[model samples]
Target chain A: MALNTGNKIPLYQQIKQNLKQRVKMGVYNEGSSLPSLRVLSKEFGVSPGLVQQAIYGLESEGLLAVQHGKGVRVLEKKSSESVAISFGFIQPYVEYMTFEGQIIHYAEKVFDRRNNFMIPKSSEGMASREREIVEHFVQNGVKGIILWPIDNDPNGEFFQNMSHRIPVVLVDRMVDGADLPSVVLDTHEAGCDVARHILGKLNCRRLLVLMDNLVISTNRDLIQGLSEQASEMGRMMDLTVMHLPITDFIQRLNVGDYSQVNMYIELVERQIREGGYDCIFCPQEEFLESVIIEPDMDKKFPELKLASMTGPMLTRSRKYNEFGVIRWVWDFPQMISSAADILQQWVLRRKRPTENVSIQIKQWQSTE
Target chain B: MALNTGNKIPLYQQIKQNLKQRVKMGVYNEGSSLPSLRVLSKEFGVSPGLVQQAIYGLESEGLLAVQHGKGVRVLEKKSSESVAISFGFIQPYVEYMTFEGQIIHYAEKVFDRRNNFMIPKSSEGMASREREIVEHFVQNGVKGIILWPIDNDPNGEFFQNMSHRIPVVLVDRMVDGADLPSVVLDTHEAGCDVARHILGKLNCRRLLVLMDNLVISTNRDLIQGLSEQASEMGRMMDLTVMHLPITDFIQRLNVGDYSQVNMYIELVERQIREGGYDCIFCPQEEFLESVIIEPDMDKKFPELKLASMTGPMLTRSRKYNEFGVIRWVWDFPQMISSAADILQQWVLRRKRPTENVSIQIKQWQSTE
Candidate 1:
């Protein structure tokens, strides 16, 4: 920290500018201690009083925390220097889910067009990996994190602590109690749209919804939407939302563990056959593949029609793709683009929105 | 017309009220000759001047038309009395397509809640039948008609004529050149969404879009969307949109002509095989049912994938419903409810919107 003190500009003010540059460059990160006043004073060949004045000015700008026994600490870096700052985007899964890559791709395009840069990482479906990746981002001093959280509330504490370090805009899967700004697709409304379709179009009275674990916010929201629609319909619809052992199964599947995939598919098929349901709706694509693979599904359950809500690649099956089950889907192109918009606004504007932005989910159904 | 002359109400006013009641009850319909002016005066025991004044009043209210030689005839029934009046809903097809009944059902529910009534008619997939239905609705003095037009531009002149007679709201299938208020789905955007998904997720450089005749607005919209997406991608994608002779074929299928079904399916199959395409998107369910029914479609074209768009019941094919061909669907419940809202607003307020209300289309896909 060499200051050009021969000029009319005071040594302390020059020192203050140098220190702010260090903060902007993330040389001293949030919650990290800066050099002692005496050390900084010596480094700058200045008096202790001048160094103290420099520190005080930075403090007034809300850039530092002064402590008597300890040293000054750097606060969160949300200042203007954060513009076009490096952002970390953690894809919820390490594995190549269809929309995951698209989310990264679309987000990259938008961020690139604005001359900002984003670094993407994968959680690898592991909470530990998620933690590690996030910590790496923080340590690297990325300006912000646009998080698409994984399920089971594994990183609640980590999210809260991370929020203090930098701005985080969640591409929300509806993590409750996080109290963070999020961009959420209105999955509940999507569920209601499904219910109305099943009742009004398919004329189905008994509806069975098979999906991921209800602990996940998206799954819960879809079920709540269905239940609310049923309630609103008033005796027109009866709904059953069944949650699988998704925590372990999806984890295994994520890691290429397919031994239990058959078991899960069979469980769903048995439920569809014996449950006396008029319609089945699955928002998760995990079981959709195996369940609809049977050649004689329509013949076995003549009265049963299935519906689904998911992203791209779930429409591979022609049995229901061309005819029976309806699907409600949200793609990465809209969702990720929306999240990127919110993230840019939150980071660039230096003011985060308190409310979560709810986007309408699209309805996909085929008619004969 | 019965008149109670001894009452405090004036004789001419009483005659006007009776004639107004006759018009309100549709005793004298649009474009039909009302009772002669002299005949009206003789029957009401009033002067021709009084009857003429009554006619002028009704004419001022836009309820009747008076010609120099011809007697008063009822004009369009788009007046404020059209409030809560019976609205005619004409489905694009006469046969039970899943969404057709649903549109009527949802529309009826909404209309019923407001103490209004609706009479639903099926066009029977015949241009002639569509014209007949509109003429019948007009003759019956239905205050408004919510028209879901048949394809092939068969009803363009009819629609323009009908708009003048009633507050007609077109559930637009992107019918161009028709200057009318419409409630339309944003199918062009939906098409672009499909294009982005194909490029971003499916990673297909060679694209093929197969559907009904491009003369239809919906098909054209979807194709245009795909083209625009390709254009926006700036040579990352090459799109080919092909049309089938859907007019005669769909009409025959509507009336249960399955003689050429296999031929049509084979034609699509040959195109898929010879095209060397990476993915195919079909927005019309009419061809989707025939295209994907080949159980060995994936085996035959192992590298090919498909996408589709339509209303409920087209997802019956479990093949694409589960895995490969993504589906973009719009349901009748939301659509009909929205259309009903517009119709109610148009008729009750005696004002019509010039812009088409575009509802977003939803995407459905499966992942491996």
Candidate 2:
């Protein structure tokens, strides 16, 4: 490790150089905890502040990391010798779901990056390109992956043809007829509950269901669930479920603009004016927020109601009770924690995870 | 690598197993791309659908990952990897910030998470925890850290210590004597600009500045900027700044209730009506939203006006815009891109970056 000696380099820089040299000399291996700053300060006969400065300097340099609840451990350095782990994510921003955050955070916490992990960018639309990227990671000797699959069940073959291989844990979305360990929300139940709440308490005769494209299993399952529930309810409910694809919606409303929302409200208003539907059941929070801004609910359709299948934000909102958003809890930490446990067992004992290891999401409906 | 037999275990599962084995054997590496389902299907003489199913299965199993725009890649198997470059965040749960989604999404796109990245969660009141976490990561050999430093530099000594050992990149905030590399939003400019927009154009003389705790540097900079601007304007403008720490405010105003918002409005009303303030400038979006729900500005104030630092939601809200909100554009992607570029240069090239790189923020005054 290079040591900074110039006074302009700061005292901490000088101390950090010594520590780096120790690491280079194999004094500190991955996962080994370092001495406390105070202890080091006393040993070096330097101020604790200087020691701390050194530590922070190393941390900022990516020679060290700081976690909230976990103590400092030697992270595997990303030297030329490090192994790589392949990962794929389907969500637009990977972090869209809080669950994703938990998974990523968990991965970072449990693995040694320098010698054990590698992640490449993954997206849905670029199928061929995604395949190339995956192959590149595999060729370079990636360990395994954690992915949120696309709706299609057949996408799994990409990894099958690879000469090299890796283990995988699915997050959020599920693959049909696949016997891989997976963590997914109970979207079917979530859909049914959303319909039941709107039909039973909100007293809606008709409803419009806004959804994403049905290419993925989640969309198919949600639509199927809602349709089945609606069919069973019969004449008691006149639910006209309108499938508005997000892409089409985006084209009209533009991303991050309210025009699409305004258009949706106008459409809803027209439906209400025509005396068709009594409620709008948005399948997601983005749509739910759209419904919230349309204040004409009291004026145009006095009896019409609105609700959606939403995450924690809906319940956390000040207008939660005012706006009916069905709570759908996805315990990310539990899933990740379990996956880690399973992965560790596999790594340490060479025991494969049994098919029975799966997580089912819990659903709750707010009566109020 | 494990091969699929299209049996009870499912073809996708078989494919996932094959990939997993290859990864473990160091055949597939992190940050490397993988083969597409189509190519894999052709090579294995299986249907494309089967390959897709396998990829999805792998995703569910946490063996493969896909990200938007970047396609599929290998990821680190756990949390203890090396972050080649660390970008500091100034706020807790930056994922919830107006532009944080884009920031993280893009970062995920370019960053090889399998190589390891450090994201330190440092809130204002949690200094001890922050220091401990930083130390742990530093000792682990993290390449760098992306942090949201604590307000008041509560962990100043800790950061100072860490800074001496590793390269730390500060995001969204700047520390006065710490010559660190930072990508920051010009909140000082944001504040002064908002104040000028409202006071100059809206003819708002009396104003109320609602500020929360200085948990992040952005918060403090925003308030400071506004105060500086107000002071510069001198007479004719009556700016009454209401500073409430987040904890104290939450205690006074129950989080779950909207009543607190009403109370704030009533207080502001009293100020405008009795105390003679004509406008209100909330430095943060939460406070801004709270103020927007109050009685109609045109009705209550008539001659009074309102402008605030707001998120994208407020800009999209037609009703909120009728009152006016300073649409502060926090370009998250720019910072992420910058960090990614910096990481590539530092980690991949082994070059020490010069300290202090700042991102400029674009402010949209409510001219409407």
Candidate 3:
């Protein structure tokens, strides 16, 4: 097809459209090489510069791959049919690397076969890095984005601007004041569920809750849920909460330091031995691994029914019930899938939910 | 192609395979009518029953559509290419309907375009319904399943059996000793986050944490986090947890019964007027909506900073910050995506993580 020089459309765009149609009609099949730029220019009576520009446009769209010596090859036929809708999934560092990997993997597995996903090569929870990732995805024309935003992100304007252009679904965290769709867990209900299990089902009256130094929103929800449940069972329940400073321990552990680990372990042992508590609740698994799993801690505190709000590392040498620990499981797949679904709908159908999605929590107990 | 009746392969299956190949090779274009059963039987020199069976098999696989008086029509030329790998997503109920719907939608969006998803028509957290849904998906050959399991599920054996056959990713809740993969949130940390926000950020010296009667794991974790943060701050923090008997209010709210909502509201008003507290923490949104949003509550408690561990219904008439309220947003999408990813891996590659995935929480303050 010859270019319409008098048309309002740019010359390069006109050439690009013609070649795109030819590719769609199977004149240029996938993996097949395209005609030389000189031949195309001569045939269309257009400058070689226009032909080069058109080819470059198609190359960026992932329809063509340019090889210096082998010539430009059609990477996909029926370009429109073969062009998968792309999505960007951005997170702050891979804290849960396997879990994050699985989310991307499963999202692709369950997503439409013609859709594609892109994630950052490395993320450090830095505002600059986050901005870079977001801008890159936007420039690449990703249909939508699923972000695990940085806590108290400073790049609110960037996110707000991006949201206006395309659907942005915040995953794990959200930036304050940014009007974006989000999918969050119902940790309040999770706390209530755990409290019910402990007070109603397990019939524990006097309980001691052990906590660490890290302050987070989930931690607050759990406390509220527990307090509410305890108050509901008032007089029948006696609860005491003990907070330990573990920021040092955590930082040291991260650097292969274990000196303070024993100090915290001994302190926990003392609390269990001295307090007349029917149940002991540890909010993190570090306490279980560092203190409870000691040689005969289970025997020493056989009467002390143990519960945690974290998952048990099943692969660890210590097994649940062996040390009498019960834990809760978070529904990550549901959260990821839901975010993807919402983002897709927002991108394809321009539909957004009236409220944020909240995933539920599950309880797990070891069977001996 | 003639049927090989003498061979081990059934005549119907052989014919079905031959027809399938032709469809894939574009011999029978999409939407074209196929020969009648009698005509096929005569042409293949086989019994009509075998020909009918072959056609029926193809029909079930979505290759052909049969109509009364009309012949079997090719629905898809590349039938197998379009068939999606389906997974079952079963939940007791969509109490969190928006959230649940988003999870399913995002899962599908990120899931392989060719893979499909199925859900129960109606579920009531009943063991029978759960059993039926699981069995149906299994019978239909779903690659895997993502379930919001019922507590103390009666169909333990069934789940165990299915786990042996295909991958099962448990969401929301889990049965005791099921040995299934799960994803859960860290409510303990959520609780800590709130405590730090109140005592450290807001500089609240005297805090009254109002809790309801529901005893759940998240509740316990929240209380633990609060107490831990409080203890770490030592003399700088004075915390009092008041448990209110609001089970009736909660039940009514669940079923659209708001009569007792006033009584709970009045109680909260009285507590604020006389309790001599600097801050009030509510674990759920219902309490904040019913009590704190009253016409003059904000004016009456001008010094009190309100916080909750749930998302604020932003579209509601009541505005946050205007009513001195801040809520935490849980990252549900991250949880769902993570779960979908893990489940997909387990189903497609037989890979399971050593532990469950936990999505974090974020805080949102009302801009108004």
Error of 1 at A274 (Å): 3.9
Which scores greater on TM-score, model 2 or model 3? Answer: 2
Of the candidates numbered 1 and 2, which has the greater DockQ value? 2
CAPRI accuracy category, model 2: incorrect
Q: DockQ of each model against the real complex?
A: 0.01, 0.08, 0.01
TM-score of chain A, cand. 3: 0.70
* Ranked by lDDT, top first: 1, 3, 2
Better of 2 and 3 by DockQ: 2
Predicted model with the maximum TM-score: 2
TM-score of chain A of each: 0.67, 0.59, 0.70
- The candidate with the higher TM-score, 1 or 2, is 2
Q: Which candidate is the best by lDDT?
A: 1
Candidate 2 positional error at B220, Å: 4.5
Question: Per-residue lDDT tens digits of candidate 2, residues A1-368?
Answer: 12212112245644765565445435667667777767777766578888877777677767766554565566655431221222333332233333334344444434422223323244534446455555444433333455555545455655443312445556666555545556666667666666676776666777777676656666677767777777777733476666666645533332234456666767767766775776766655555554443454555556656655543333233444455444555555455556554543333222345543444545544433
The full ranking of all candidates by TM-score, starting with the best, is 2, 1, 3
